[model samples]
Target: MAPGPAPGPPGHAAPDLATLTGVRSGKRSYYRAYVRSDERMQRAVRAMDSISRALVRTVEGPRGLLEEVARAAAAHLDASWTILALSDGHLRGARPRFLAVGPDGVVTDDDAGLAPLVRRELGAIRAGHATRSDDDGPWVRVPMTLEGRQIGSLVGLHGLDAAPEPGDLSVLRILANQAAVSLHTSEQYQAGVALHRRAQRLYDEATAQARDLEQRTQELRQAEQRLVLAHQRELIDTERHRIARELHDSVTQYVLSAGMAVEVARGEAEELGADGTTILERLGTAKQLSQDAVEQLRRAIYALHQSHRDTVSTLPELLHEVAEHHRPQLQVQVRVEGDVVPLTTDADHEIARAVGEALFNVATHARATRAVVRLRYRADELLAAVADDGHGDPVELSRLLRLERGRSADGRHRGLANIETRIVDLGGGIVFRRARLGGVRVEMRIPLPLTPTDRPGVISGLVGTPGDDRDDRSGDDTQEDPWPR
Candidate 1:
């Protein structure tokens, strides 16, 4: 255009100051673009490195991790201040804790009023809504999500020349992801520790309860043992006293009677002067009394060893012993009918005791010359009766039996109540009636089980003839119900 430039090479331009200057200026612009791109990549790498390091340090504590996240976000985003708020309300005491960081250090902001705003943003992000716009605003809200669950928010306040660029938002999003993972991991670890502590406390309480129960069980065992030992000692004492009373009442009385009979025989021999026949008769009588005493002694010794003996006592033998025991006091006779059944030791003893008591009462109160004991064995039961031939007041005897609480005038009524109790306990019933012999008759009937049971139970009502016109009293009057006192 200006007289044309010098001829240039084919398809090439001529050298000129303006062209050289333009080429140099293009190279400068390209170099400047490359340098700026390299600087941005380096800054992004450093920011990622910082985020990685901050996430690694999140294991220290929940508060420490929050503070680290806040600091890293503030520095990376070039913000005046950054806050990490737990929008899920995972904090203890249900109080919101906002961790804020600035360029200088950690700072406290009175953002209690902003809690509602932060929650709204977090809800919107969790619900998959578009992010809130804050292009020209001083506050930027970004959700911190993990596994697609929004845990909290990262709110930053800053004064920049322009709105946040895409690169800034990218870095902030990467940091938010890391922070969500770190915070979630830290919260999980804390929850695991709390659960473990609670389980340990419950285990300790159960162990303590087990120990106390074991101690109480041992104490109960010891107490039961002591009670058993005490019961055994009491039983031994009772058996000893019973043996003493039996010996005093039976053998001792027989020996005394024999001594008196010997003295009488000696006096009769003295009265028969030169009469050897009468003397021999008196000596024979003394010999018979001595023999009776010896027989009683033998019976007493047998009773003392009754526990170790296996011999079963028959009903006839029991009645014979009762008759023999009271032979000296009255003309006691025993009559047996039917087959004699074998009885238990307790039954035999109680039966014999009742017979002895009835005979003794006849001798002491009836003033009868003859007393008879009749025993009969039936298919399912046994019956025994003691009768005397004398006139005795049945009404007075019934009154005495009813008023047993009063002491007897002569102790003659002793053991009458015991006889009643023993026969009742053996599933037997006793009745007082007027005998055909014109005296009192005491009759008893006891039941036997089909299978031979050891335990004895009471059968209601007495089964026998009424004693006298005055002896007709109800069964209730004999057992639990008392006659009008």
Candidate 2:
């Protein structure tokens, strides 16, 4: 290759008026060839400038530098094809791809077709700021040098008809060198963008997985809860059967035996007189005791029955309704006060039902003419109290605490033991004393769990806020532990 004008076949002068296929004659043909050659040079120069601009643009955006530069150059240079390949690696356009123009107007920039030696030479040429070539002169790789460093190479074909000029190749080299620098910057940016996209996709996937996992965990918890409830019901059913058997074996037999003895004494009364009468009286007492036993057994069975709707039980409504239900004969007044804010995540339906049971006990056993059923909700505690307008007898209260059997002053049955046991299980306390109305008052207080807040929110009662205690019972409030059960 030489640095000079390209040569063509000599032109022949002919008659000015001569005519031929799409031409006047010899002189016109020569003029056409000269114009074509000049156009080729102009196109090559424009292509080089386009390559420079394209490289710069690729660095600024997502477009691959090599692809943009090579494709543009091929079009501008009026070549049939163009390709850009990386000097550093294979067919990667994002990595300093170099352009090559063939004499036949065909370009092969595919990294796959490029020879390994050529690729190595391009890399060296870019790094060392020098050009290298193979043994044959047909292929010449012009190094694209910038700031004393060869970023890559530009190769052009040489044939017998066209001997590559040094000046033209140099021009190509300068443009290629500019493209190489721009491509290097663009490649770095491209790699960074790829990394960022990968990270964002991972983050999104992780977030979706977390939500799915949480949903699965909740489903598992629900399934476990159902299993526990079913098991509990089975146990209750077994207990009921056992209790029914006990009642038949003990209380029923005793009542039947006592009746037989009374009948026998009546039959012998005429002969045995006073002794027979005494036997009959003793049998009567025994029968009465047997009947009382039957009643107690029934109550026990009622307590043992398992509820399927346990989860849906609303303690306050149940309590208030019980008080009102029994208000007619007992002259009991049902008063519901305070707040019991329901929590969505709370699974303590048993606790609420237990509270309801306690209220039921008050109406049944307290033997009061008037009763005040209070359900108070403070920030820190939930309290319920059933006070009665009955006699001031602390003896019944003591018996309830001891869970011992003692006849009620009114000669009615008492349910104090069950009530006390339920309240104890609620982590609460109870106080039994004379009310301001001059009658026995049974007040029970249970602490509400603290809601999530910066300060110990809602210390007590409905008036409880961050630092308020409007419902803390004064002087007569007693605290009871719920774990004894």
Candidate 3:
């Protein structure tokens, strides 16, 4: 029309100076078009900025990021209402599967507060009845896709005077696709956190169970040790009672029979008058010695026969029983000078045997009439002493004990040797001293905190006659004996 617009090259449109010059070319129609294009670009820039902000808002979690995306779409389309929803079967782990923004720009996960059109659109999206919209109606729908698969839609009802262009639809698609990728990432993060919590709980339970098992194992070990000790004690007691039975049935009867023979000989010697005087005197002495020997054998048998079950479990109570056995022939008294200390059962038995040996020597070789056994408990050691009123020399007895220990085992002074061995095995010492009661005093110093060795039958083997065989001696000749020949 003004020489007409020059025909542009082939299919290219004629360039508009209004776009290059902006407001400087004040033609009314071109200015209006320019203003429209500028506003659209500004809205697109704002929409892209919203997507950028939403992408970085992962710390606010999936729901917050989704809401931000919804608001960005609404602003881009200049919409009065908007809906963002995942299809029912898609992104099942994503929370708040549906999101709605009202005309008032209020965000909500539930569709109840949305406008009727917005709520209807959300239901359609959730029910899979809606897809990306391509109509010229006021409504616009774009798919939010992940890896090219449509998971949900971003729907909007615009309130603008102009319809959204193709460029506007492109911005909405970008925003929707970004929201899909972000939601998928949020679902994975949540799954990892839940798995970590469950794993920690199982580890704690396993640790507690292991600790309980260790404690029970230690208790079982301690119980096993106690059972072993108890079984050993039972065996020792059974052997002691057996030895007692043999001594009483065989050796005791032989000594009594020998005493009877001596009495008969003395009566025959008396009938011969002065011719038999010296022989009668010798027979009387032999009879007295036999009686003494019989009393000593009875005491030994009584001690061996005493059962551990029949008495209290204390050293003083055991010493009292030993004193009672010796009381018939020699007046024996037991005194405890301090508080009683507990010791191993085997150690107590050995100490009691040592004290009984001392009393036996007092009754036989010491020629003592009375004896006292004292147990004095001290800070570091136990003082067990046996004193008697007799005519025995301590020096001679101590010398004999040293000689017996130094020499070979020939069955002489076995009692003194046994006393030394018992005390020494218990980490203690023994001494023979002059008694305040006018005879020999045997003192045994056993160290305190006495945990005796587990040797069960050591002291039991030392009982009865030193050299004689203990196996059934009832058939042996009683006339060929050591009682004054």
Candidate 4:
């Protein structure tokens, strides 16, 4: 065992009482000092109170406690190495990181405990038991406690020349106790930080997954539109063929009879010889008009077949019509970027109508002086945007779409439903947002040659409803003007 404190001349006053009470040990030395000393116990208590306040103010948690104790021990005892260690529920480190100091006045982590006396002393400190080594001035360890609960340890090596007096040892124990409380607080704080990180990771992963799913859904919708377009074109061709047979059976007979009547009248006029020239000219003009109708029908059939040879439409021609008709002062712009496959008739029709609707919405809602229209032909679909510079929030576009459904004056309403429905039918959609110009903006997209296989049930469900047998005859009359004053 380590040698006891040498019997002292006069009473040995403790150098630091804060350490003694904090460690929950070494009360006997203080009790003896209080009883025989001329100074009252109150004076000792007052001095310790000041030291305790200072230690508490500087400490954070167990880590702070351990560090403070080690620094105090190292400076007072003048030992080459002083260390304090505590586990954070992990046992991997060969030595604890709570605190450590090495010989030669240098602090290092890799030091091994070579003396059993030191090990036993440290073990007792962690276990809330005070212990001393066998050397004359050996290492001492004492457990730091708060409210009777063991938190960690305080350790110090007593150099041969710097053995601690009873009062000094008591002060060291008190510091150890305070350190234990700080360590517990720090551990709890670390645990909270770890949990916050885990939660953030989960949120990021979930957001990525949602975006992936939305992209896949858009692709599927585009494919379905291609399939519906093919079916509609085929049906239109069949209906035209049927109409051709009807024209041959009914119209051809009527036209031939009428031409014969005209010929007979012309002959009569010529035989009469008075107004032959005028009568003959009238007959010829009527015959020419009849023939022109037949030729026009023939040309329409050729125009329909031309799509098979060249699948793309002349987009500039289509937009020119809308631009030509647009109101003055509103600049309608159309820019085609690259080569893209021609969209089906329905897709083309729906896109055009949606764009027109977007323009209408802009004209009524935005009070901007100028507006811009943009069209981009990607490899897959047609993207069109109608934007105005009146007022626009770049993101709050969906709310505007809802407003379009509501009524203003005269109970009149804006028809966003037409735009949305048509966009959806073409395997595309419209989204409203702030335009680059500072006004309301509307974007419309339609996939080319959309296929039903992309959305198997959709084309079958929407195009051919339960009682609808005449798909060949069904088509939108979008050629007619939407607004007629």
Which model scores highest in lDDT? 3
Q: CA lDDT of each candidate?
A: 0.62, 0.52, 0.77, 0.56
Q: How many residue pairs clash in model 3?
A: 1
Worst 10 residues of 2 by lDDT: 456-465
Best-matching candidate per TM-score: 3
* Per-residue lDDT over 78-165 for candidate 1, one digit per residue giving the tens place of the 0 to 100 score: 6766766656344232222456665576554345434454445445443444456754347776776767766667777755545666
Task: Report the lDDT of model 1 for residue 441.
Answer: 76
Each candidate structure's TM-score, on Cα atoms with residue i matched to residue i, is 0.42, 0.46, 0.56, 0.48
Model 3 CA lDDT for position 241: 84
Candidate 2, superposed: residue stretches over 4 Å from native: 1-171, 247-379, 387-427, 432-441, 448-485
* TM-score between candidate 4 and the true structure: 0.48
Name the regions of candidate 3 deviating beyond 4 angstroms.
1-27, 50-59, 112-116, 129-137, 219-234, 247-401, 412-485
lDDT of 2 by residue, 33-136 (tens): 66566665775767666665665563345334455455544444443333333444422445434454343544455445555544554455435434444563
**Which of 1 and 3 is the better model by lDDT?**
3
Please state the error at residue 158 of candidate 3 in Å: 2.6
Worst lDDT run of 10 residues, candidate 4, spans 466-475
Clashing pairs in model 1, backbone N/Cα/C closer than 3 A: 432-467, 433-467, 434-467
- TM-score comparison, 1 vs 2, better candidate: 2
Instruction: Judge candidate 4 against the unseen true structure and give its global Cα lDDT, from 0 to 1.
Output: 0.56
Given candidate 2, what's the lDDT at residue 415? 52
